[model samples]
Target: MEDIPQKHEVINWKLEQLLVFLQYCNYKESMKGPLFYAKILLFGEYGIIKDSKGLAIPFNSYKGALKSVKTLTGEAKKSNSSLIGLYDYLAKLDTELVDFDLKSFKSDIDNGMYFDSSIPQGYGVGSSGALVASIYDKYAINKITVLENLTRDKLLKLKEIFSIMESYFHGKSSGLDPLNSYLSLPILINSKENIEATGIPSQKEGKGAVFLLDSEQIGETEPMVSIFMNKMKNEGFRKMLSEEFSIHTDACIEDFLQGNMKSLFGNVKKLSKVVLKNFKPMIPSAFHKVWENGIQTNDYYLKLCGSGGGGYILGFTEDFEKAKNSLKDYKLELVYRF
Candidate 1:
């Protein structure tokens, strides 16, 4: 008789835990859900692969969401077909490590499912990342939500999971893109082992700004990555990466985070030069002169936005209107202001 209340208390505690678990389960559909956005690797680029620090920020100008439709048609059908392929992949993934509610996912596919997205593919922004985030959100069982009490272990675990999931698109993935899009927050990669969500200096509506220059052509990441991998074979390239590439990239990250704008531009210029001289094949020929012109004139500085083969060229300028006037021929979208 004495143990009855104790057992009742234990049962009540478990019920409470079960209620919390149920709340987390319905957190997405019932309340605020996810709308994953594109991500911009503002710094590091290829250098991150060489163990350099990287900074990534969410680009909300484009985003993707998972939705249900009455019928699949047009591009939705094509996208649905692609998702079916993903379904096959996820079904085979190890359940102990990362499991999804595949039954529901398959049913959704059968009932006309598609990822309606505005994210441009192979444009250096995270198109596949948005898809990975969406899939994880809808299907991943016992998934870690950004809202949970987050620890470094949990963060790393999430990144590991995302890497495997995103690898379906890119032959290999750092998991940074999906992580950035999942959190929709600026992420600072101190190193591969040390990464955390970080806050950047608040935007000031001033003449100085960061912007994206449209290359107007698709940049395939896999081949660009392959090129980088091939370049890794050269000792000179490795030396340049260690001494110049990583140096400029790390300095630029420090300068940007510290809001040392004057110094930031100098480091950015050095980075632009390094990328131009070393990463020539990655940059389109048409923009090479202009990329150099910016370095010469100081109107703006250009650097690779992603893997660089083609997509968006990241730019920084002391004066936006002046930069705009100088770059009138090309499409420039402002990303950040200072």
Candidate 2:
């Protein structure tokens, strides 16, 4: 087993973080800086890759912020090292849409800057996306600010820029994750080219809810995505993805946005069933039984949260209490209430 940090070591680390925060305030940048929140793809996970509709929203429960310390150790030290690679990638990037203050960024990284983030890596809640957003927010020159009117053209431009920037982390990225984290708003993807800021129905004080089921394992995006791509090569898989997966995914997005609960659940059930039947590799093996149990019992419906070999599995249920009882063995985190 990995050795845990001693209590005193933890305290010293916290003190170093506090000192760095004070130094950060003394700098010309905005105080405390801006936090880049993790994002959740509420609908259209795999579907979005093929130009199907997608809806992603900021998940404030987990977020990342850029922090600096004169000296770094442990996790922060590791994060700083990773940032160096990202910096190297960005420094050589030749893009007209976006450019970074590579000198200042490198200076900070050399002086012990790291992402102090609560978001868990490989959980599909956009840990790398948050990191990418934070880097762009801090270093990008003449970057588009969220304050400005986000025209369709501008949104697509941002997505394109983010796509290239974030490709360093994931071999191929849709860029939707970083884009959603950067804007910190609900993003609706009509297709690859048509994306816009969208509004979701406000949460209501009802029993029906959306929740995250902890799979107690981290999921690697690249491998799972490779599996998806390999599967796409099969004509039958392509047909099912377009005809069945995309259709139900699109309906779920629309129904969710419009707050058509009855229609939404109905479509979600179908979507869940389709995912179970088709995307078995994407769903964690341990979860297959429960995934089916939800569908069979109507207690809750399970769907992939991101690539989903493991990590948090998205669940929807008419009764949160019943779902909780049904899923008593696993950890549940509430995301949205109906």
Which candidate number would show the highest lDDT if scored against the true structure? 2
User: Candidate 1 local accuracy as lDDT?
Assistant: 0.90
List the candidate 2 regions with Cα displacement exceeding 4 Å. 1-32
Q: Count the backbone clashes (under 3 Å) in each candidate.
A: 0, 0
Residue pairs in collision within model 2: none
For 1-338, candidate 2 gives per-residue lDDT tens digits of: 99999999999999999999988767535323578999999999988888999999999999888888777999999999999999989888887888889999999999888998999888889999999988888899999889999999999999998889889998989889999999999999999999999999999999999999999998998999999999999999999999998999999998899899989999999999999999999898999999999999999999999989898899999999999999999999999999
Error of 2 at 65 (Å): 0.4
lDDT of 1 at 285: 92
Q: List the residue pairs that clash in candidate 1.
A: none
Q: Give lDDT tens digits, candidate 1, residues 190-263.
A: 88888888989999999999999999989999999999999999999999999999999999989999999999
State, as a TM-score between 0 and 1, how close model 2 is to the true structure. Answer: 0.91
TM-score, one value per model: 0.89, 0.91
